[model samples]
Each structure stands twice: as structure tokens, then as C-alpha cells.
Target: MKSILVIHHGQGVGGGLIALLGLIAELKENNRVHVLSIFDGIAVDYIRQTGATVTVAKSRFYAKFYQLFIHSDAAYFNIIDSIRNNKSVILYYLSKYYFAGKELKNIVFDYEIVYLNSIFISDWARASKLAKKKVVIHVREPLSRGLFKFKYEIIRQTINKYCDQVIAISHDNASRLDLQHKTTVVYDPVVTKNRSQSEYKLINRKFKYFVYLGGMARIKGFEQLVESLEYLDENIRIFFLGGESEYASHGLKRLVRQNLDPFFLKNKRLIDKLKKSGKIIHVGLVDDVFYYYENSIAAICPFSKPHASLPILEAFSVGKPVIVSDVKGMEELVDSTNGVFFINSDPESLAHKINEMSQVTEQDYEAMRTACMTKYKQIRERSDSVTSVLNRT
Candidate 1:
């Protein structure tokens, strides 16, 4: 059995973390797998539950610095704030390098491969190469835009120069980077058993609610979703399944304020109305996502960015349709058969799509639900097996 070290950026309950968990579960059947997480959250416990040894390398300084660098709108202020708040960032890097080097020295003789689960931790890839082990870099996020584009470019260059293989979650993500020759596209796996119509009805008996899952980031279109609530009918309710804490909700508001899109600002009154009406329920970070999926009418993903979303796949796995933004990676996943696509960042368009979904006849809805199952099977069939990608000859 091959011994592998998988280093990940965060333990947040997002697509990347979920995908990593699926991979870990598969890999542990034969290989000796150990996980190193840079940040701790719900995902850490999930990883541990899968029987993989998990190590958390805590660095508040690095975390704060990275957050500020990426999310803060004012570049100058962000740099200043990062310096002021994370004075230990430099020391943290030095300590990380030292610890990583020490860890490599201890395990280099035994571990055959080191897998960098996210591009944010490219340092691990470099360290793994230095230890003369095969380095596999997984580019899960679209890195061509946003504040860390330069850092992502560096990672792409590093992968091109030193890493043995690069895995991208989607073709769009792969096309955006420069490591095409060594890159392999591996869609995240979905394994949900089929449930009978009676079972689905029992779970979905209460409310005809739509669900939104994932981080409440601006790029994920949280603000747009909030804005669209005003245009939605009062009978239409939405359950937000992620964003675990009050801090996360507050931080989302802060980001909205910072990156206030003109369309969102224009529909600010509707946002206020939805807040007061309580139509949008925030069911923060529940352990069982299937409960939310089984109960909801459909899944909604109004992301403005261009990355493949896990919620879309999760919705399909549970035999539910999705209403996603018509953006690059996201649009590639949904078509008229399984789900509806709204124009990206346009609150009115989202509102229209939500209305359209509400009006779907029982017959049409059943057809869409069947399409979701078929699409899920097609995706699973097209995806390269995680084992084949990791255990490459």
C-alpha cells in the first residue's frame, strides 16, 4: 500500500473539503493516508471520522492575512490591515517551512507521494519535491481572477516546473491555468443511493422550500440571492444550509458592503424586505445536509464566479433539480433538462427563474428530477476514478 500525505488549506464545509473527504474515503481502502489541514472547522471532524489521521497546523496570522488579501476590497487598506493584524505572518511562514521540512525528513523514507489538495498550499508541493517524492497538485478553485491571481500564477508555474501531476476539478478550471499538459480533469464523486418516491415524499412533507448551500462569499452570489428575495413571491421560501456562524453571516454583509454591485445596491430595498419577512431561513452548517436536500423543493446556486459547485452535484445526487447561474463552470453543469440557468449577478433574472421553477407542473418537475439522476450517472461515468488519478504509474 502506498503512503500518502494530503495537505489541504481549510476544513470548512465547502465543495473542496467535501471532494477531499470523498477522495480520502476511497484512498483509505488500500493506502495509508494522512491528512494535514491548515485551518480547522467542521471538515476536520468529518475527515477524522473517515479513519484518516488528521493533523492541524494552526496559524491565525496566516489565516487573517490570506483572508484580508483576498476578500478586502481596498487593496491598499488590505495590505496595511494584513501587516498590522498579522505581524507574525513572516514568522509563521518560517515556522511552517521549518516544521514541514522536519515532517518531510521523518516521513520521506516511508511516504511515496504527497498530494496538495488545494493550490493555496503550494509550499507543500515544493517541499514534497525537495523530499524526492511524487507531488500531485489539485487545483480545485478557479485561480485566474481575484486578489490572489498572482499567487495562483506562481502555483501554476511551480506545478508546470516541479510537480509530477496536476488535477483540476473541472475543464474550465483546467483551461484557465497554464498546466494543461500535465493536468487531468477529475469531477468530484457523488454516491447517493436511489430513494423511492414515497421516501422522498415522507422527507419533503412540510414546506415547499428551496435550498442554497456553500460559503456566503460575494463570488458565490450571496448578495444577489439576498437581493432576489424581494422579487420572489411571499409563498416561496429559501433555506440557506451553510455558513455556520454569526461571524460568517456578518462577514458576508461586510463583503457585500465592500464589493457592492450596482444591481445589488439597486435592489437593496427588497433585501431589507426579505430580511424582515424571514422568508430566507439561515440553517447554518447542519451535520446532515441530506435532511435539507430531501425536504427542499429544489437547490439554488446563483454564483457569479466560474467554478464548479458541489451543491449542484449534491442536489442532483438527492434527485432534486437546481437553479444555477449561467456562468462558465456552473452553466456547464446544468441544462434545461435537469435545471434552469439564470443570468449571472442579475437579481431580476434570478427572481424570474425562481418564479419559473415555482410554476413547474408536477409532470415537468418529475421529468426534471429524472434528468437530475441521469445527469448524475453521466457525470460519475465521465469522471476519472480518484484512485487512478492518485495511483498513477
Candidate 2:
């Protein structure tokens, strides 16, 4: 059995953590798996439940540093601002590395392979390389172009230099990062055992709303979804099943307060009306998302950027279709057979697609649902594609 050390960014209940949990479930059957988390959150208990040893460094320095860089838009436009951002980044990392090194020193050499679960945890990959251990970096986010593009470039370069292999969750992520020969694409795994037809039937009777199951940030196309509510039938309701990032939420609130209106005014007004009318519901951060998935008509992932969305896979696992943006990673998972696509950030297009899905006959919907499960099964059966490259060596 292989001795594997998994280094993850934090214990948040996001797609990356869910994917890591699925991988750990696979690895623990024949391997000695130990998880080291950078911070403590909801995922720690879940990881422990997977029968793997779990440890937490409990550091917030990196997360805070990241927030500073991403929130400072002026840094991208001005040299002085960029230099200030760089200085803060350097100082924070220097301190973080010192503490992280001391905390991880005893365990860094214990495993044969150090599996970095996300690019955000590259420091662990660096530490593992310095200890002369094999390292695998998983690039779970499309980081080439965004507020933190400069930071992401540094991370990409670091992984290329220090890691033995890189795993991208989707082809789009791999291509975007320019990780050529050393990278492999492993589509994220879905844990199917948790689902139940009886449970679906029971919970499904409670609600008939459409669902959105991720961060409520602007880049997630939440504003667009809100805008589309205007075009939807008055009886149609949407259940938002996740919380918002504090950074994005704060920025959006500030914009609204200032009357700068980053999102369209009509969209904002429509969202308010929907909320008042009880047509828009926010069910923030539930423990069991499958319950929500089971009850909902369908799932929607409208990220403005390219993303390998977990909600799409989860929806498919539960025999539900999805409406996704026609972007790189999203397009890879959805099509006319299983699900429909809408123009990214276009509310009218998304609304039209929603209406089309609403109009699908019961027989046709069943066919689409079957197609979703078929696609999911095909992905799950690719054993060779899912295996870690370190195992090949």
C-alpha cells in the first residue's frame, strides 16, 4: 500500500473539498492516507469520517493575504499599487512559510507521496519537494485570468518547478494553466451511495423550485440568474442553496449603498421583488445538499468564468438535468442531450433556456434525466483516467 499525504487548502464545504473527499474514499481502501489541512472548518470532520488520519495547521495568513491581493483592483491597473500588493504578499508568505515549515517538518518526510489537493496549497508541495518526496499538484480552479492572475501565475510556476506531476480537474483548467506534458485530467468523482430514490421521492414532495448550489458571488453569474427571474413565470421559484463569500458580498453591498450599481438596476429590483414575493429563497449552507438536489426540478451553474462545477455532477448523480453557461469546463459536462446551455452572463438567454426546460414533456424529461445518468456512469467507469499518475510510476 502507498503512503499518501494529502495537503488541502482548508476545510470549507466547496467543490474542491467534496472532490478531495471522494478521492480519499478511493485511496484509503489500499493506501495509508493522511490529510493535512491548512485551516480548520467543516471538511475536517468529513475527512476524518473517511477513515484517514487528519491534521490541521490552522493558519489564516495565506487566506488573508489572498483576500488582500484579490480585493485590491487598483493593483492590477497601477505599478505603485501592484508593488504594495507584492510587498504584502512577500511579507505574509515569508512568515507563513516559516511557521508552516516548523509545523510540517516532522510529518513532511513520513509519506512517499505528497498530494497537494489544490493549487492554493502549493507551499506543502514545495515543502515535500525540499524533503525529496514525490509531489502531485491538483489544479482545481481556472486561475489564469482573474483578480489574482499574478498570484496564480506564481503558483503555476511553483508547481511546474517543484511537483513531479499535476492533475487538472478538467481539460479547460489544464489548458488555461499551460500545464502541458506533466498534467493529467481526472474528472472529479461523485459519491453515488448516498443517494436514494425513496429519499428523493419523500423530500421531493416538499419543494418544486429550481436550485442553484454554489457561491453567490458576481462571477458565479448570480446577478444574471436574479435578472432572469423577471422573465420566469410568476409561479416559478428558485432555491439558492449556498452562502456568499464575505469579500464579494461586502463589495456588492458597498456598490449598492453607493448607488454605483455594479449589477443592472432592473435585475436588482426584480430580485428584491422576487424575495418579497417568496419566489427567491436562500437556504444557506446546509449539511445535506442531496436533500435539496432531490427536491429541485434541476440545477443551474452560470459561472461567468470557466469552472469545473461540482453541482452539475451532483445533479447528474441524482438524475437531474442542468442549465450551464457555454464556457470551457461547463460545456465539457453539458449538452443538448443531457442538459441545455445558455450564453454566459446573458439573463435573457438563461431565462429562455429555463422556459424551454419548463416546457419539456414528462416523457422527454425522463429521457434527458436518463441521459444525465448515462453520461455520469460513463465518466465514473473510466478507471484508467481516474488513477493517480504516481501509481503508474
Candidate 3:
């Protein structure tokens, strides 16, 4: 059996973490697997439950360094701040890179293959290559063009030169970096609890609400989703199933909302009104979102950015249709057969599509549900066989 070292950059339990856990479960069936997490959190506990050995590098300095790298492209830095912190930032970057590489090189010598869970840790590919180990990177995020072009170029060149193979979560992500020749497109494996599990807590059998999975951040088109309720009838409602995101666009505004109450900060009066009227129920981060998906008429994904959402797959796994925004990577996953699309970032359009879906007849709805399962199976066929990709690497 091959020995694999899986390195994940984040500690939060999001879609990427879920995908990585699924991968580890499959890989450990025949191969020896070890996980190196950058920080310690509940995610580490989840990884341990997969029966894989895990090492938590809970480095506060490394955490800050990683955060800077992630948010460098954002408008978080001003000229004054840059001028004041330039020298210190450069020193910190160099020291962190060198020390981290040295530590990783020592850890990787025990494994035959080094698998990077995200592009953020692509620099470690070089250390793995130096150790003469096979390097495989799972490209989760789209390589967008922005202020971080130089950083992206470095990552692109690193993967092309040092990595043996690249596993992109979506075609749109691969095409962005122009790594088609070396990239294998593999959708994330979907995981769900059995139907015999307990029912949704707040939602009763007669509730007419759609489930919204994922973070409640502006980039996720959450604000637009909230506004869309204005157009829908008072009886129609939304059941938000996730919590606030770490990297949301407006951090200060979100903080204010958090201080006021953890549920929602945007459209405050409207949200309060909806909650009191039993029109909007925010169920933050449940252990099993499957019951929520099973009971809802459909799942709604209103992401403005390019995303390979897990909600669409999770919804389809239970024969539930989706109302997804027509954005890159996301739009490619669904069509008129099993799902309806709305204009990206347009709440009015989302509401219109929701109305259309709500009005679908019993016969049409059953057919759409069947199509949803069919689409899910087609994707699952690819996701389940990812062991072949590891074999090649």
C-alpha cells in the first residue's frame, strides 16, 4: 500500500474540509494516510474520527502569515500601512517560508506521496519533490486574476514544474490556471446521513421553506438572497443552515451584526420581521443538514463568485431539485432538467425562479426529483473512483 501525507491549510469545517475527509476515508482503505493540519480546531477532531493519524501544527505566527497570503489580494492593505509594515512583512514572510519548508521536508520523508489539499500550500510541493516523493495538489479554488497575479504565477509554475499531477475540483478552476494538460477534474464526494436519522429541529412537516447551505457572506450572494424574500409571498420562507464566514467581504459590518445578534446583520428590520412572522428561520451549523434538504421544496445557492458548491450535490443526493445562481463552475453542475437558474447576484431573478419552482406540478416535480438523483449518481460515479488518481500519482 502507498503511504500518503495529506496537508490541509485551514482548520475550519467547510466544504473543502469535508471533501478532504471524504478523500482520506477512501485513501485509507488501502493506503497509509497521515494528515498535517495548519491549525487546531474541531476539524482536527473530525479528521481523527476518519481513523487517520493527524498532526496539528498550531503555529500562531504561521496562522497570521497564511492569513496575509490569503487576503493580500483584497483591499485590506493601504499605502500607509504597507509603508509602515513593508520591511517587517518581508522578513516575516521569508522566515515563515524557510522554517515551514524545513519542517515539512522533515515530515514528508516518511511518506512516498505528498498530497496538498489546496493550492495555498503548493509551495510545499517543491520540498516533496526535493525528497523525491510524488506530489499531487488538489486545486479547490479558482485561480483568479487580481493583485496576487505574481503569487498565482509562482503557484502555477510550482505545480507545473514539481507536481506529478493536479486534481482540480472543477473545470473552471483548471482552465483559469491553464493546467488542463496536467489536471484531472474530480468533483467532491457527497456525504449524507441515512433517512432514518432524526428530523429537522424547527421545520415541521408542513413548513414551506427552502434550505440555504454554506456560509452567510456577501460574496455568497446572501444579501441578495435575503432581499429575494421581499418578492416572494409571505408564506414562502428560507431556512439558512450555516454560520457567518471568516472571509466575508465586509468584516466590520458583520462584526456589528454579530454584536447585535449572531443570526443576521443585513436588512435588520426585515430579518427581524420575517423571524417573528415565521418566514425566516436561521438554523446555524447543524450536525446533519440532510433532513433540512429532504424536507425543503428545493435548495437555493446564490453565490456570485465562481464556486463548486457542495449544497447542490447534497441536495441532489436526496432527490431534491436546486435553485442555483448561473455562475461559473456552479452553473455547469445543474441545468433545466433537475434545477432552475437565476441571474447571478439578482434577487429578483432568484425570486422569480423560486416562484416557478414552487408552482411545479406534482408530476413535473417528481420527474425533476428523479433527474436530480440521476445527475447526482453521474457525479458520484466519478467522485467514488478517485483512488485511481492516487494510484497514478
- Number of the top-ranking candidate, with lDDT as the measure: 3
- How much does each candidate deviate from the true structure in C-alpha RMSD? 5.3, 4.8, 4.7
Clash pairs detected, candidate 1: none
Q: Where does candidate 1 stray beyond 4 Å?
A: 40-42, 58-99, 106-109, 145-152, 191-207, 244-275
Model 1, 1-393: lDDT tens digits are 888888776556666766777788889898989887666656788788778888776444444443311221112223434454354434434534565555555443367888888765665666678888898888776765446565445456666766898888888878877678888888887633221123223233344588887545556777688778778876777877666222223567557544643434434554465457566776666555676777777898888766777778888987899988877776577889999889887999998898889888999999999999999888888888757877882
Cα lDDT, model 2, residue 298: 85
lDDT of 3 by residue, 1-393 (tens): 999988876466667777777779889889989898766667888889888888866445555554323322212233433553454445334534564566675463378888888876676677778778898898877765556566567668878998999988877877876878888988877765322265536655554678887545555667677778778865677778776544234678556545553334444654454456456677777757777787789998887676677778888988999988877776668988899989976889999988888778999999999999999888877552456788877
The Cα error of candidate 3 at residue 87, in Å, is 10
Query: Model 3: what TM-score?
Result: 0.84
Worst 10 residues of 1 by lDDT: 68-77
Q: After superposition, how far is residue 10 of candidate 1 from its true place, in Å?
A: 3.4
**lDDT, candidate 3, residue 380?**
72
lDDT of 2 at 271: 51
Top-TM-score candidate index: 3
Please give the TM-score that candidate 1 achieves against the real structure: 0.80
lDDT of 1 at 77: 29
Sort the candidates on TM-score, descending order.
Answer: 3, 2, 1
